[model samples]
Target: MRIPRCYEPQPMNPGDSLMLGDNNVQHLARTLRMRAGDQVLLFNGDGQEFHATALEVDKRSMQVRIDSGEAPKRDSALQIHIGQSLSRGERMDYAVQKATELGMARMTPLFSERCEVKLNSERQDKRLRHWQQVAISACEQSLRCTVPQLDAPEPLDHWVRSVEADLKLVLHHHSATPLGDLPRPGSIALLIGPEGGLTEAEVQLAMASGFRPVALGPRVLRTETAPVVAQAILQSHWGDLAGN
Candidate 1:
């Protein structure tokens, strides 16, 4: 059976016995029904994977002994920081999840002119935590030792002006420029619009801030689907996805 992976946000050393967190404990003990002597993989977002054996397991808790740690070279060579416009319901969640699986280095939820999702401070914090957990879950499933950084939501204008990268791209269906024409970049900052799409002024503002408008194809893609397709194309072109 494939050993389940859990993310533990703490330093782990070989030979150290560690108590699993409540979330992980519940998942392993109740959900997975893992018992004593079952092996589990642990990662702390430190780009290292720890092999561990369950010493004790019950519905309430689980304790594991670390066997060893290995740092696998699984991270992508190209770094991508995406500025994704906030969408409603499962759309945003799907974008974050798929982006994490695609090896996005960082993601910042963006507020644009057409953005419809409204959240007060409390709801924003709640959503931030939820997205972080989503990224963690994706990491576990993708076997990514390092979890992608999910930044708190920020204005698109601010993100476009402040984000630094070797290359910056804003998805614009009207653009005649194709992605293949651009020079290869070690790092990229990508801007994606909301379901209603970015206003012409918003696109101009991003362009003035140094993001080049690039087209994926003739047909327009949904906000959530754009990031997945764009990142896959980018990764296949210049990142680790090509090798895989």
Candidate 2:
């Protein structure tokens, strides 16, 4: 059986004995029912993976010894930072999860004119933490060594003006430009609008801020689905998803 991979948010070195974090402990010990000597794979958001063996395990905790470490080339070569507008329900969660799997370098939740979701400071913190965990879980499932950075939710205009990248794109179905027509870029900043989509003024603001309006195809995609398709296309064109 493939060894379960766990995210241990601590320094990991070969021969180091480490106690798994509460989440991981619950997964390995309580959920998976792993016992002593069971093999596990671990990463700490570093660009490396460590092989480990369970030393002790119970319902509440699991301790493991690092057997070895390997630096795998799992991250995408092309960096894609997504400014995703917040959506209601599980849509935001789905976007964050898929973006992480697609090797997005960074993601910032955006608040646009048409955004339906509202959060105060406390709720914002709670959602940010939740989205971050979602990214980490995606990394584990996708076998990625690096967990993509999830930034706090910010206004659409602010992100469009402040984000840096070689190429910037705002998804607009009205645009005639295709992804294939764009020049290859080392890094890309992609903007996805909310359920109601970006208003004309908002699109103009992004365009004025250096984001080129690009269409995926004729059909308009959902707020959550746009990032998945956009990232896949960008990754396939210039990132690691091309050959693999």
Query: Which has the greatest lDDT?
Result: 1
State every prediction's TM-score relative to the real structure: 0.97, 0.97
Q: Residues 1-244, candidate 1, lDDT per residue (tens digit)?
A: 9998889998999999989999998889999999999999999999999999999998898999999999999999899999999998799999999999999999999999999999899999999999999999999999999999999999999999999999999999999887668899999999999999999999999999999999899999999999999999999989998653
Every model: Cα RMSD to truth:
1.2, 1.1
Residues 130-217 of candidate 2 have per-residue lDDT tens digits of: 9999999999999999989989899999999999999999999999987767788989999999999999999999999999999989
Q: What is the lDDT of residue 143 in candidate 2?
A: 96
lDDT of 1: 0.94
Residue 6, candidate 1: C-alpha displacement in angstroms? 1.1
Structure candidate 2, residue pairs in collision: none
| lDDT (Cα atoms) of all candidates against the true structure | 0.94, 0.92
* Superposed model 2: Cα runs more than 4 Å off: none
Estimate the overall C-alpha local distance difference test score of candidate 2. Answer: 0.92
